[model samples]
Target: MTLSFFDQFMSPVLMGIPLMFLALTLPWALFAKPSPRVLNSRMVALQTWSIMGFVKQIFQPLSTPAHKWAMILTSVMMFIITMNLLGLLPYTFTPTTQLSLNLGLAVPLWLATVILGMRNQPTHALGHLLPEGTPPLLIPLLIIIETISLFIRPLALGVRLTANLTAGHLLIQLISTAAFTLISIMPTVAFLTGLLLFLLTFLEVAVAMIQAYVFVLLLSLYLQENV
Candidate 1:
């Protein structure tokens, strides 16, 4: 989308908000611990894991390369989600909608798949990716489809996130403008639309987190399939 004059000039500066928030805020969020009165990201992830039926595991988390990659993936998802929600603040441009922002998320994932796949199992990964020894006649068709599907993974994730945040922001903007126009900034229609926008704001936050999770999970599953 083409930005307005103000947006054009401001978009570059505004985009940094997410990076700064993730870089600065995330460290504090991670180091803080769970308590009776406090809720932290780690605690929340664990709680969500349990509620989602991943409990009863006794094995300690390994320090293997696989483990590290998983941690990185989870951390990136959380950062993206948090920044997305932050960008939903009134009048702030959300960076998640930018192609550059989503590309940052996708490129690393693609690289990780390549690096970790070979590291985990070289021959088997090749098999999963290529499925060698198929009939010659069908080989070209299968290869074409596989190549397209392989490349589309990142694009899918990026577009999903960018579009969701951008669209939500636009909706809020429209409602906000219409409210001001119709209600003279003083009364009933104003109050109603304002409340509606507020509700949409919260929903946008949830969508932000969900898109991040979907992007990360899809990456994981693709890796898993190849493994």
Candidate 2:
């Protein structure tokens, strides 16, 4: 019974090959291609408008030097949000829910920011480890604590995204299962549960988008500190 709830998280297989790649690429295919005409389709125009707004909001707090990452960051946010929202659909897989995939995305970007900081301003980067005017007795301990905190950033990023999505999915699954089971025995209770499920589903959709934004926003903040 427990396994039934979590089994959905496993990547679906077709002819012994994982379909995770297909799930990742399907979001791109869902968007309408731009036409070579003067006027575009309403869907294409809406997508373009949304993307432009997102890019502007993301780059607003970034420095000019960091603006070069605009494309990569925006693409990542879109990919994550798409996967998250798609997973809400029946029988769809979410790659971002996997800790491995989340970590893969988080670590490289986080490390790039850290490495950029070290390369461009080594003194400033290292200075984060030890504060000014610290007593000689507590300097070493403070440095150790700060160093640990610095290295934990990428892990925090990966775990935060994974945990939030996983928790939401689990709650939805549990409530849905209970509602289904109660339909025959207690129709009224089941109806109420279904209503609750409806509200939860909407909240989960918001969470899906917000989590993607937050993940990208944190990376930008990290880049801001570095650049």
Q: Which number leads on TM-score? A: 2
Task: Write model 1 residue lDDT over 104-145, tens digit each, in one string.
Answer: 779778767766777877887666545668888988788787
Model 1 scores what on Cα lDDT? 0.65
Task: Give the CA lDDT, 0 to 100, for residue 151 in model 1.
Answer: 77
- Candidate 1 matches the true fold with a TM-score of 0.70
lDDT of 2 by residue, 1-227 (tens): 35777788898999999998899899988877899999999998998998899889989888899999899999899889889999999878878889999999999999999999999999998888999989999998999999899889989999999999999999999999999999999999999999999999999999999999999999999999888
- lDDT for position 201 in model 2: 96
* Cα deviation of 224, candidate 2, in Å: 0.3
Off by over 4 Å in 2: 1-3
* Alpha-carbon local distance difference test for all models: 0.65, 0.91
